[model samples]
Target: MDRTRTRTRYFTPSEVAAHNTTSDLWVSFLGKVFDLSPLVACFQGDPLLLPITECAGSDISSWFDPRTRDIRRFVDPQTNCIRYYTPRGRFIHTPPSGPRSDWDNDVGEPWWRNLQYQVGLLSEKTRWIRIVNTLTSQEQLQEVCSEETMEEILQRYLCYNSHARSYTWKFDGAILDMSATLMENGVPDDDQELDQLGLDRDTFIPAVLLHFNDDLTEG
Candidate 1:
């Protein structure tokens, strides 16, 4: 008989949340979890240069992209919804001829590759969804609502509107009954999970309209 042991590679939400401190940090990106404890040590005593400490033990999936070197995505306030920016115009390309010529033309892989700090897989329940407000035409917001109520979801967006108390939520063209709890309504309670509301994981929930009541005193 042969005996061997394999390391565990999957992690639950509770397990990941437990390590959400600067000294012991873990975050998930692109479905893979990473332990950032070592990186935090490098930035110790230097809080101004880079604020990696702020992201300790937090899911930074939205903050970092592995494809491009553009750092704008990390700092943009509208990180959730997609927006197209005007191109910076074309530039002349002059080929360099030297022993290291290949390096000049090649763009390197994402920064995450250098860290090699993978820890485990992200639990499915922790996945998030991007919701858009068609009425305001504002940036989309991401929400993870496996355990939240419909009222709770509404509260999250209240800050975006001038009249927080006067707003209606719609899904698939039907107005949602805000009074009903998401769990009881059977409308996919979790943004990541599938529900009869006809929402796909990748698709955005459209037209969250806000309407203010007429001020009778003004009349």
Candidate 2:
């Protein structure tokens, strides 16, 4: 999912929610999404995997300390030593309590820290937009991450228009700032207001028209 070289990949919470099965598990923790299906398969039948499986398609940011970017810990009363406080039951990646000789020491990096398991960043916000091609009179309705810059959005639109980079992006007759995110470019996100007013979003999604620059750039 993070394969696009020119674009930064982002996933909405609902998008991550769709992969909530054991065979297609996805979880977001500390603002990053992880595809943990391989880990689930590797630790199949282990009770420790329960916490992760049960909370699939949800944020687990609470499990970590924001400052340290590590698991939250508490002082164990009996041992008087700090221990990871996983109220939902320990998961497969949790460090062993009171290290035992049997616990394998060669497990490599934890799933949360492994780049192989990371898919994308969790979108802070998402908005609907339409890309209208002036030359072809074509229109494509898109649900886009609000954090995307005009250039990144162009990268996303390449599937529809191979020469997207050769076009000028304009919203309301003003050339867009390619370096800034949609919000920073002054495209307001009014989804929340639309929801409050009970208005259908399809009719209100902003449109950005593309005018061909005729550079004849080749892929």
Candidate 3:
């Protein structure tokens, strides 16, 4: 079953960049080539609440090495700044080990919060693309995995700004306040006001769970 040896084909540097597409693009192509990529399902929430722009201007010198694969920075036709992609996996600091008295409240952390935020903004619609490559430098993405390094990454995130040509009240506010509001109020509740807005209470809370799912469900 190790396709890497049998069916796997290798791409040279030019090939990787010449036709390399986002992850989503690979999924469609993978089924035709390997028949292994599945249709990754997710909830209909705000997919990219936090953009990778936050990671810009951070001390990612260590993560930028070729070994860890923690940090990836690039400038393409999409967002103009450096796009940092890290190998972030989900972790459960707390478990829903107890009874499901309030299953809604028991939602866990989401594995893709940081990346989702970035992808969400980049992709206009609710869906985005994901591409996988063995040649993807490990050192580039490694910065997101370490706790100490992640803290540093977040600090830089707090300073990120979207140079949107349009005006909006949301971006004008402080990042901490915006993130806090999203944490406390972004989730939809049964409350009359939130219900009218079509938001769900459990929607945003589980983003903290970090490992339950890849794509988020609608909140």
* Candidate models: Cα lDDT each: 0.49, 0.84, 0.25
In angstroms, the error of model 1 at 69 is: 9.5
TM-score for predicted model 2 compared with the true structure: 0.74
TM-score of 3: 0.17
Best by TM-score: 2
What is candidate 3's lDDT per residue for 1-219, written digit by digit as tens?
A: 322223223222222223222222111111111111121223212223122122222222332335543344445345455544333311112123333663455345333222322211111111111111112211111111111111222332333322211111121122112123222323222334555888773342212111112222311
Candidate 2 vs 3: which has more lDDT: 2
When summed lDDT is taken over every stretch of 10 residues in candidate 2, the lowest stretch is 1-10
Q: Predictions ranked by TM-score, top down?
A: 2, 1, 3
Backbone-clash count (model 2): 0
Q: In candidate 2, what are the lDDT values of residues 49-162, reduced to their tens digit? A: 999999898889999899887789999998888988899987876876787886786878877788899998988888889998888889998877877777778877899989
Q: What is the number of residue pairs that collide in model 1?
A: 0
Error of 3 at 116 (Å): 19
Candidate 1 global lDDT: 0.49
Residue 143 miss distance in model 1 (angstroms): 20
lDDT of 1 by residue, 1-219 (tens): 111123324555666677877788777666667786776665556433143445555665554455651222322254544322212211112122223533355534433454477875665554343444454556545443434444555566566664555645555445556655344444453453445666674563323333324321211
Q: List the residue pairs that clash in candidate 2.
A: none
